[model samples]
Target chain A: MDAESTAASKGALVDLDEATCWSLLGPAGIGRLSWTSGGKPFVVPVNYRVSDGRLEVVTAAYSAIARECDDAFVALEADSTDAEHHAGWSVLVQGTAAIDFQHPSSDGPRPWPAGVRRQLLVITPASVTGRRLT
Target chain B: MDAESTAASKGALVDLDEATCWSLLGPAGIGRLSWTSGGKPFVVPVNYRVSDGRLEVVTAAYSAIARECDDAFVALEADSTDAEHHAGWSVLVQGTAAIDFQHPSSDGPRPWPAGVRRQLLVITPASVTGRRLT
Candidate 1:
């Protein structure tokens, strides 16, 4: 699109509410997960689910991420924009992370949501913050 | 926009090229900078510039990021979508980070692109990877 066209199509802004924010992430199968490795930060894209006000994600136990979680703070964020770029909201959750090794491991007909995975990254929020771009 | 409209307007995909990836970020003032804090991960939005094949971002010396950069790796990424959602590209740089203590400290005219501030997050990527969504 041309600069003029792009500027003219900025679109209408949508007001953000708790319901809207929840809706944006409820079905978004993908989100970015960030963590620190040896002091610097690393961000990895992963499939996630929101359950009980926190994000529950599964990863391979032998993944580099699991090997590096040395009892430090971590966060997860998800965002999406509409066709007009008029409305979008971002939810950020900050909290402690742990490996839920006891998580179920099964791939039956009715798999548990994100499949039966042996490893789980459980994020317990110390703070839940969100923002909407209007 | 309704779900049907959103799906119908996925737009025409754009061909990927190195020049296109560079151009998308060269002018976009905002990008996401991710790093590890403690043992978890954090993603922060900041205004950045593409300079010398690496991402140069500035922050306060006392910023939590600065304190946490205790000899570790870091990464920076930028992405943008067009009106049609048909084309976009993302550039990710992974590298070692160091503080440029002697970085120019000034707000003078043409102040070195991203302004002269207290701290600099110099991401010298061991691997610079990029992807384009067409």
Candidate 2:
């Protein structure tokens, strides 16, 4: 069975279609970027913008993300939850990250932390999957 | 330099001590769990509770997390951010995960998704690190 059917069997989660996943990713937002470093997984929250079918995040040149994620396979997870209502939707993007110095748009999403975040890492997605909690 | 000094040099990020990291983890809340599967990384949002100096989360027995994370090294990241102010703090827990059928608590955090989520994954943290955006 595929992911959708597997989630369907759970009864509480409904698999979202690819189109819906992209829609929920929105034009810009916050998400968590995860990657393996030194044989252990690391995750950190980041601000991102969706542009030209890719997700882009700016980071300080010396940040761990910039240092470890360039040319790496990573995952970015974004979601919105109403904990009080016990409802939310999450989208996961599996992708290859590369530092995009060539086409770094001047209007891309800025890093939240106060710093000279001049490096832009663009994630070219390999798969986009999502599920909604009912 | 250590993690604290590395972050200090960035100027915009302040390294949070171990005590502060635990304090921010609080008694219970939401976080993102990340681990490697098939040599690739995956991350998902999860509801969690802190107990006995460890973090616990419930997942469907057949869920991806349950299937892949047992006896594995994983990371859990939780944070609070005010997008408008561009300020917030994030805490990261790097640990080992084990399914705790031996001591499944009756009052542990329940899964947000509707399901027979009876399996409890206990994460005994090896390192608790955090940083705050200035």
Candidate 2 residues B10-50, lDDT tens each? 43678999999999999998999999988789988899999
Give residue B112's error in model 1 in angstroms: 20
Report the CA-based lDDT of candidate 2 relative to the real structure.
Answer: 0.87
Score residue A41 of candidate 1 by CA lDDT.
60
lDDT (Cα, 0-100) at A88 in candidate 1: 56
**Per-residue accuracy of model 2 over A14-126 as CA lDDT, tens digit each:** 89999999999999999999999987999998999999999999887888998999999999999998887778999999999998877654457877665466789999999
Q: What is the TM-score of each candidate against the true structure?
A: 0.55, 0.89
Checking candidate 2 for backbone clashes, the offending pairs are none
Model 2 RMSD, rounded to 1 decimal? 6.2
User: Candidate 2: misplaced stretches above 4 Å?
Assistant: A1-11, B1-11
* Index of the highest-lDDT prediction: 2
